[model samples]
Target: MSDASLNPTATDRWMLPEGIEEVLPPGAWQLESLRRRLLDVYQRWGYQLIVPPLAEFLDSLLTGVGHDLDLKTFKLTDQLSGKMMGIRADMTPQAARIDARQPGNGIRRYCYIGSTLLTRPKGVNGSRAPVQVGCELFGSDALAADAEVVCLMLHSLEACGVPATHLELGHMGVYRALLARTGISEAETVALFEALKRRSIPDVDHLSASLPENERELIRALPRLSGGLDVIGKARALLDHADLTAALDALEQVAQCVQKDFPDVDIHIDLGELRGYTYHTGLTFSAYRSGMGSALAHGGRYDGVGASFGRPRPATGFSLDLRALLPLIQAQATPPLAVLAPAEGGEALEAAIRELRRTRPVIRRMPGDALEDYSDSCDAMLTCKDGVWRPEPFSNRS
Candidate 1:
């Protein structure tokens, strides 16, 4: 063969950019089925479904969490408005916007399922474009709101077939309260938050060195306060500021409610976990399971996220990557059924095909085509017998 024939052209390569993936065949079906089931459950729970545009003005998209979201979002200049726009990196903020618009003093529940694009991959196995499915509860400051959101997060995982999951709970309020009492600079607090989030003891100690002995000790101790139920007691004893006390109490209340409702769920506490530090106001939690390195779902309370939209409301919610959870799900296989029809058939055969499709997936085979052409896709074939078309199992016995 000539060199031209051997070498692959750009189009011939047919390669996708890194971090993007296409779901084919049965995998696509599985993801869609899981999405439908999740939305169905959310609907039953009174979460009205909302579909936000994939892109929005950067100002609205970034809203309160601009610092955290800027790096992850994809920006573009809108042709229509000549203004900056962003493809969403996360959908939680959009859900918050929708909730802000609802006219009610009572709680509003909203759920959404859509694709979010990121500028970079979240982790080694993470996808840049993830199908983000989540629900948000608005207008409640009660601890019960936090518990309900956490419970819904756990149930979502269970519905997706995650096994032996454990919830790691934390309160950003604890750490935030400590920072407030320290009277630290904004830059210093940001540095401390990063250190505690990574659980870097050396960094935490270095940053807190300039503070007073009591303040320094408390700052250093934040990252180490993590464990089971006992961690709450440790937090209460180690931190004594009024805000800190309130935070610990709120966390304990949420823990009690979650434990009472979900007895089987293994719960662990990490007082240092500042996952959504910039955005989360109070309690935060993440659910992790065996065989997965990352949390299956995560969310927390962000009390003032909707302020920019002109209607501030306390909100709590969780989101999971639907495509990521597909492998963990033990779903049944769906095979296509092929119905063979004559090249020139009457309207009766067409009617029969439609009827069969109602119960099971049915595909029509053209006349004079070899059965082998339909062998791979068709699990069963329909043939006319006694003047009526009946489905007969098609087994490719080669």
Candidate 2:
């Protein structure tokens, strides 16, 4: 791609940047309906809603989030102070900053849905501007909190009518423990993490070459440790470290709770699903529709996200692309048909229009406007007959 190639011709001037999109008509309406529906579900779960700023100081935005987000964020300079600023690529950190201001260690539940502008797509042809919806719980380290969040995630997908959803659970702490036992430098740990994420045997072997035999063997098995419930048992038997047990217990407990509640949801365990490996502190899970290659929703515990705000409290959450959900949202109710009003209207017609609008939409025809102007929206017209105004089926005459 060159500068010349970047130049837009007149025919392509309306072309949006790659990976960016705009929802139109009924799709936008459906998207809003899903947003409202899920937010209501979150409210019922006692997760209060909050709207974080779309952009903020760069340091404030990226300080405690991991390198993955650091790469996705779009940066700019604020004119007021010459300070660097960034458009939010993820709302989790901003929510954490808000939580850090709380007075006590009491559990605070918050939910948010907003536009997130990423510098690049998250996956192939993924949206760069996603209407991200998520819920965050702070101040609790118990596995119960993890389970509760997972439950809410299921409720979210169900509310949107997403079907055949399966969940894959992982524990970053397990991977972290193995990495720690290796006693490798920060750089080495990061390199090994990348290799494990890819599950490349050659890379894993090469990276763990100098590590202890036991430590190397444990981590080398982590990527391949994804499957049914038996994966938990397998990891327990294969891993010799006691530290690994706690993380494993956390994963199992959360998995059990999810299974018991969401009986139909197919569950899989993936120790290598190091979603935000350097960022997430503990149990992580992602939900996928049967055939979709990418996760529709995913979240994990990222306890240190608030440390930069001076309050290091436990936190966990998940986010999904609301705009991406428009197609899959099958149950949105049809909005009521709008009623049309004649441009020439007396006090009676005006009052009738107002009264009708109270229950449903009413589109008043402007002077010089024909009935066809609202043909796509309005079905009936308010008519003055005798002394009363009543609605009659509207027919376009010209």
Cα lDDT tens digits for candidate 2, 275-374: 6876888999999988788888899998867888898999888888888877666344554577888787788888888898888778778888766777
- lDDT by residue for model 1 (25-143), tens: 76787788889889988988899999999999999899888686899999999999999999999999998888887787789999999999999998986799999999999999989
Candidate maximizing lDDT: 2
Give each model a TM-score: 0.90, 0.89
- Clashes (backbone N, CA, C under 3 Å), per candidate, total 0, 0
By TM-score, the best candidate is 1
Q: RMSD, each candidate, Å?
A: 3.3, 3.1
The alpha-carbon deviation from the true structure for residue 21 of candidate 1, after best TM-score superposition, in angstroms, is: 1.5
How far out, in Å, is residue 127 in model 2?
Answer: 1.4
Candidate 2 Cα outliers beyond 4 Å, as residue runs: 1-13, 330-336, 370-375, 379-398
With a 3 Å backbone cut-off (N, CA, C), the pairs that clash in candidate 1 are none
> What lDDT would each prediction earn against the true structure?
0.84, 0.86
